[model samples]
Target: MRVDAFDFELPQELIALRPAVPRDAARMLHVKGGVIEDRMVLELPDLLDEHDVLVFNDTRVIPAQLEGRRGEAKVGVTLHKREGLRQWWAFVRNAKRVRDGDTVEFGGGVEATALRRGDDGAVLFEFLGDEPVELLLERAGTMPLPPYIASKRGTDERDREDYQTMFAKEDGAVAAPTASLHFTDRLVEAIDAKGIGRETLTLHVGAGTFLPVKADDTADHKMHSEWGRIDAATAERLNAAREKGGRLIAVGTTALRLIESAADEDGVIQPFEGDTDIFITPGYRFRAVGGLMTNFHLPKSTLFMLVSALMGLDTMKAAYAHAIAERYRFYSYGDSSLLIP
Candidate 1:
């Protein structure tokens, strides 16, 4: 399908800047068997069967955004993915002036050696730090908010808690598991009380998630790789749930993608850890995931295409039209949708 097939009008005002006062108070759009229903996030448990399985991406969002100085010039660095032991693919502001081989130094004993310039003009850097990179980020890094969010003096403390999920365990993602943002401890308990099963897997959401589909033909677009893992423990539980007439419901596109990527032709999930660049488009046969809970995405983005794969192109187009008309929230800090195939 053409990349334009997923395109829709999204008003700027509809883009959410802050999370709902009570997380679970956000709206939810439920799509099942090509039928769509308007609902609330708190009402999720009522929509599914008691034995259904819900899978979540437990990758923690790191404060990967940093500010560094090139001599007297200030530059912003947002790490997309770890390249090597110390090297990372970082989006550098004012990188045009740094040139190759220039060094950028940050506050609090943080520094990086610029390795090379990428096709998108992003810089490859080898960071200098005795402690773990995660520690460095804790002290000096900023939250990697989306491009749409306007920065103030810098990333604030609220992003530290708001951008992260309650179930976040593994540390790797630059972006948050947006759908999981709507889930609170109380919400989890409510779902569990309904007898629904839950499982956790890790898929470090790379900056690739925000990358738009540049190719006119969606089929030619190449997806960036991100590290994901489904351990034997999680796999066993998930497979058992599938056998019990339970729907394997994914909490976000990241988890859904990894589940589909890790499953075989017979729909058996296996242990997986490492990079995955699996891209799903229309007509692709899904293997494992039976349903999905995900945030509304940017227009013409790979995420919107992923939604088209979960539902149909026609259904998504109609749903998005209604969302735009009704002014439902959009993007990372937005509302969510529950899609069933």
Candidate 2:
């Protein structure tokens, strides 16, 4: 399909710069079987049944945005993936000034040598120290905010808490699973009281999620891989939930993608650990995930394509049109949507 088919005009003002205060106060658009309903995130517990299970991505966002100097030229680095104990794949700004083997010195005693460049333009970097990479980032890196928001306002102390979800535990992700950001302790308690089951998995969201689809056609676009894991116990529980006639409601696209990657042709989920470059597009049949709760996405983005695949293209276009007309916020810090096909 043509990538332009997923394009839509979004007013500049609609992009959200900050998450809604109280988080759960954010509006949610419920799109069920082509029907649209306006609701609030706090009402999510009432939206599903006792038998339904909500799967969450527990991958914590690390401070992956770094600014450094390679000799006289300034370079920006956003670590996207972990390659080893001290090696990472990063998207380097001002790549023209640096070469393979060149060392970039980030402040606070953090430094890394460029190993090589990938076909996707990301540079492989190995940190030049014995200390844990997480510690190095703590001293030098800031929260990796989505460019849409960061381009408008600088990242601050507020983002250190606001950008992370209450479920964040495992540290690896460069990006937060925005859908989970709307969740709060109060909301979780309400969900638990309603008997909605909850589960967790890990998917270290990479900076590639922010990359645009420059391809003319969907087939021409390539998705960068992101590491994810689903243990055998979790897989068994998820499969059993479905077998007992319960729906698996993925809390975000990260969980949805990981679960789908783990599901078989028969839709039974299995234990999985490794990278997933699952590119969901229209005409692709979903396997395990029954519903998805996610934030609004960019125009012509892979996320939009995934949502379009979940609901039909025409249905998603109409749903997005409704969202825009209703003035719901957009992007990572934007409003939420519950998609049930």
Candidate 3:
């Protein structure tokens, strides 16, 4: 399929620079069975059932965007994917200047070396100090804001909260599990009171999630790998829910990818801990997810492709058109959509 086949026009005004005031006040577009219905995030309890189990990616967004000096030359790095506790695959602006063996020092003397460059234009990094990257990011890095957002008031505060989901606990993601942003404790209690269960998984959403489908042919585009994990306890409970004939719903594409990656051919899911570059395009067979909650994605992005895989391409196109006409917000910190496949 051509990547251009999935392209659509979105007004710049629709790209949300900030989240809605109260999280649950954001809109929700329910797409099911080739039909679309408008709704609100607070209506989650009414939209779902007792026999449904919602899965969320609890992978926290790290303050992974860092500004540091490489021998007095200005360099920006976004630590989007982690290889080991101290190693990472980072995207560097003006990366050509910082070739192999060069070191970048962050706040304090803590530093990381440019081990090399990868095939995908990512810089291979190995931290110089013995301390883990987790601590380093927390101490020196700022929340990695999306490129589209331009901040003037203060760059620090909004990103700290906006770029993280309410349920995020595990730290790894360079980006937030967007759909989970629309949720609030009140809404969660409502869902729980309605008898819907929620489970947690981890998928360190990387900066690659924002990469455009550079190839005109969507099939030719390569998907970037992201680390994910499912604990044995969560795996057991999800399997139990399946056995009880409960519907399994993934809260975001991150959770969807983790669930799909862990499920076996028999539709049984095992605990997982690894990276996945599973590009979910149209015609791909789905094994574990029965429903998905996600934000409107960029045109020709892997996310759009994933949504196209869930609902047919035509239905998604029409639904997006409806969203555009309705003046719905788009992207991270944007409104959400629930797809019942």
Query: Which number leads on lDDT?
Result: 2
lDDT of each candidate versus the true structure: 0.87, 0.96, 0.89
lDDT of 3 by residue, 192-246 (tens): 9999999999998999988777788867788899989998999999999988999
For candidate 2, lDDT tens digit of each residue in 223-283? 9899999999999999999999899999999999999999999999999999999999999
Prediction 3 global C-alpha lDDT: 0.89
In model 1, where do residues sit more than 4 Å from their true spots?
118-120, 151-154
Cα deviation in Å at residue 182, candidate 3? Answer: 1.0
How much lDDT does candidate 2 score?
Answer: 0.96
Please, what is the TM-score per model? 0.96, 0.99, 0.96
C-alpha root-mean-square deviation, candidate 1: 1.6
| Models, CA RMSD each | 1.6, 0.7, 1.6
Cα lDDT of model 1 by residue, 1-341, tens digit: 78887787788888898888689999998888778778999999999999899999999999998888998898988899987767888887887767778888888888888989888777898878678788888888888998887442346889899999998999889999899999998899999999999999999998878877889998789888899999999998899999988999999999999999999999999999889999998888889889999989888888888888878888988888877777789888888898987
Q: List the residue pairs that clash in candidate 3.
A: 3-218
Name the lDDT value of residue 76 in candidate 3: 87
